[model samples]
Target: MLYAIAAVILSYLLGSVSFSIMAAKLVKGIDIRQHGSGNAGATNTLRVLGKGPGIIVFLLDIGKGIAAVLLGAALSGQSDWVPVLCGLAAIVGHNWPIWYRFKGGKGVATTVGVMATLAFIPALIAGIITILVIAITRYVSLGSLVFAVLTPIILVIMEASLPILLVSLILGIFSFIRHRTNIVKLWQGQENKLGAKKGQ
Candidate 1:
């Protein structure tokens, strides 16, 4: 019980780091959430800062997810469900941070991170598909949405554990829910493209 609680806390804190926010502050002394698209993720970073900073933030955000899940796995060495809960907590933290006034990114990068850690093959497959979708469509939100919705499907196809599959399904649904605004923008054809150059 103690291990589970500790793992959840640790994972949440790890996810709450918010690399985009920190990177924006470090690179420009600004809050990324105040900029283009009003989002604090790689796509917005690319729009406001440039490709370099955006890529850095993306990698770092993904790293947070991976680190949180791995930490959970390490802490819950004896139990599988504990790590699943820990990984889910990390995703929750990324989406609704306790330290960021409950506002944070869409959690796509972090979700990719957690999924990758929990089920490497399925995650990698899903990531490849996501990249392809983004590259072909030029819509980051679309790619992320599809990826989020497909994670649990990939898990089932790959024959992952039932608990992991169930939690991943919940995570996927939540990720899509958080993208509700983007979904509307997408339907209205007002959604931003993946690449629009460094700045306006």
Candidate 2:
């Protein structure tokens, strides 16, 4: 139990290292959260810093999620739920990072890593749907919301463990809550689409 607790805390700390913020500072000497959508995320990275840095930040953020899960698995011993909980902790940390003054990115990229690691097939299916939505509508936030909302349903259909399903549900709720502003903009047709300019 002590090991599990330590792993969870470690995972949160890992997630708190915002790659977007680091990348922005390294590449442009700017705080990413002060530009674009004022979001410390890959989408804003893409908008502010362009493709290469954005992709790098995305991959790094995903890697953090993967590392957290692996850390949990290594320390969990017989508790299968520890890894899932650790993944959730990582997402929570990404959303409200201690290192970044509680200002952090939405957890979509980290969610991708966590869900894909925990339940591959279901996550893949939901990922495909999300990509399709993004490709068709160009709304990254919408795609993210779809991915969050659909993964748990897919997990339930696949007969995943209750703990995993519950975690996914919580993640979905967190995604929606974090994206509340985007949801409003989407309804008002004022949300930014992929490839749109920073202020467009």
Candidate 3:
């Protein structure tokens, strides 16, 4: 129990490290949340910074999620829920990082990391489709939403364990909630696309 609690706390701390902000500041000396779509995630990073910094931040964010889950697994010792809980803790930290005044990016990248660790097959399927969607539409938010909605369905179809399904569902809801503004923009055909100019 003590180890599980420590893992969760450590995971949250890990997730709280906003790589996008770090990348922006390191690469261009600007706060990421003040530019582009005013979002501190990979898509906005790519828009505000460049491909190199954006990709690095994205990968690092995913890595933190994976690391968090692994930490839970190593500390909790065969406990089924601890890892998933740690994953959730990471997502929550990413979404509302204490280090960043509780203002953080949407948890899409971290969710990818967490869900992939928990249920690889379902996450892979959803991720592939997500990539295709982003490729075709150039709308990262749309692709993220699709992944969030599809992963739980795939998990259900595959008869995954309850905790995995539950976490996926919660993450799905979080995605929709976080992207509500983007959803409206998408409906209005005003959402920014990849490769577009900032504030376009």
Per-residue lDDT over 77-153 for candidate 1, one digit per residue giving the tens place of the 0 to 100 score: 78888878877888888878888887888888888888888888888888899999989989888988888878889
TM-score, one value per model = 0.94, 0.98, 0.97
Q: Cα miss at 121, model 3 (Å)?
A: 0.7
Better of 1 and 2 by TM-score: 2
Q: Which residues of candidate 3, in runs, are more than 4 Å off? A: none
| TM value for model 2 | 0.98
- In angstroms, the error of model 2 at 70 is 0.8
lDDT of 2 by residue, 1-200 (tens): 99999999999999898999999999999999999888888899988999999899899888888889999999999898999989999998898999999999998899899888888899999999999999999999999999998999999889999888998999999999989999999999999999987621
Instruction: Please give the CA lDDT of all the candidate structures.
Output: 0.82, 0.91, 0.91
Clashes of 2: 0
**In candidate 3, what are the lDDT values of residues 1-200, reduced to their tens digit?**
99999999999989999999888888889988999988888878888888888898889889888999999999989899999999999999998999999888998899999999999999999999999999999999899999999999999999999999999999999999999999999999988888997732
Q: Whole-model lDDT for model 3 versus the true structure?
A: 0.91
